[model samples]
Target: MERNFLRRLITAPVAVALVLGLAACGGSASDPGTPGANALSGSDQESTDKYTTEKVIPLEEVDPAQLDLITEGTLRVGTLSDAPPNIFIDETGKFTGFDNELLRAIGKKLDLEVEFASTDFSSLLAQVQNKQFDVGSSSISTTDSRRENIGFTNGYDFGYMAVVTKTDAEIKGFDDIGDGKRIGVVQGTVQDDYATNTLGIEPVRFYDYNTVYSNVRNGQIDAWVAPSQQAEGQVKKGDETVIAESVINTQNFTAYAVNSGNKELLDALNSGLDAVVEDGTWNELVKEWYPEREVPKDWAPGSQAVKLP
Candidate 1:
């Protein structure tokens, strides 16, 4: 599965843009005491508190043998720890997010313990395909190319690609990003593909999200294109950035992917997902993670109505 960008940015109430000077002026986005400085102290404290108090469903009732897990009693999973609102390593070194929570819930249902192995987003699918991990849950979007090597459960969320720029930048949206504009995108992501193949603009590639936000804030790049939720997370963390409303609204269905031909495990995941949706767990998660948007009523497993290049 291909990686997609954020949705959180699209739903966030627009904050007043901060005026940051150009890169040539030695402006730093990481500078403290500045307006919208990307500070994480508050976020770290909150994450620590949340992880400490959060209650999970008990798993004593379900048996792992029935589910046929990779490690007998454990669900070995692979994911990226930097993607917020989906899966991210908190300041306390614990994985926390909607995706992590959902996977934990699935583990409870299957009567299996979840053991997560963090990897680079670019290598997540390959690891899952090679059976190094039984499943991957990194907000992965089901793509034609990925379907060849992996099997995806029903999509749990929709991810939209967005363009983020410094508040004072002239570029407003995708159309404004001409050849002269330096665009930053995560390497191996759908955003990278879109910037290169669809828009025909070669983007300044970054391996991590923090670098993209820093570059944009420092005026090193004209704009950063990524998942709306991820971009929104960065903005919320005090980055002086603004998400363009005119985004590339690709309806990418994000799902958990298993190795190709692992029909038993795939079926079990789909069943667990169906249970969550039916029991209102899915709705609760959507509200918790994406309070700005309504839960999709017709969403189901393997539902990818809109395809992207």
Candidate 2:
């Protein structure tokens, strides 16, 4: 009886474990009913359809003054500086990555100055909702529960989940993650949801990508469940960590988060996104940042009305 109880305790959702342990390193809360909570399941259509809007408002229709931005004529974006390729600050001290650059192009279409600020992934959504920033641009995945707290623009990217382990660790992939192996995840991310709610394994949560990846390197954790893009960014040559496996997880399309009440701002950003896609800027950035990644046939960024070139 004691052994079975211990097993059950260990296998409980990560959120529950965090609650019991009073850990500050986890996400806000887990809602199992949220679509795409399980990265291992769902179809491309199922994931992308909800984020697709019927129409995108023209940029000319949006008035920056009426939008109540933190700073007029500027988009104050909250993003992570540690996660590279997608969202990170370059050595030149400029925020220049695929996600930020794409947002900058979108800003150009709207004639708005795009300024970025760094924040923890765990607090970004709430900060956006509270108007600390005009938008959250951390390559956030759209989910139903998240919508209740904040609004999201039409998806600009899809994602893949990966299992990053030390080269010598026995964890080969997602299948090898559970059963008492110490797994690390960045708090408040979909990767956290996958380990906590989908796989039924409590994870050691960290506040940022750098810390979690450090733990994986130092043998403090056996594996790190992370977004494939960020994992690839952190695991460089001479780093003994290897991406054991990665699986396509378009279950949730990644979009920028805005305050749910800010319909005007959301529509305007969506419009700018469509414009970027139309101008070939979107395609150019995709090829530049993710040259090796093959976009799924069924998936493209922007609204349903926009067609990818």
Q: Which candidate ranks first by TM-score, i.e. highest?
A: 2
lDDT of 1 by residue, 144-260 (tens): 555656777766675455679988889777557657789998776766655655455668988778788889999999999777778766776466688874232223356787887
- Give the alpha carbon lDDT tens digit for every residue of 68-92 in model 2: 7999999999999999888998999
**Cα misplacement distance, residue 150 of candidate 2 (Å):** 0.6
State, as a TM-score between 0 and 1, how close model 2 is to the true structure: 0.85
Judged by whole-model lDDT over C-alpha atoms, candidate 2 comes out at 0.75
- Alpha-carbon shift of residue 32 in model 2 (angstroms): 8.3
The best candidate by lDDT is 2
CA shift of 271, model 1, Å: 0.4
**CA-only RMSD, every prediction:** 13.3, 8.5
Minimal lDDT window, size 10, model 1: 44-53
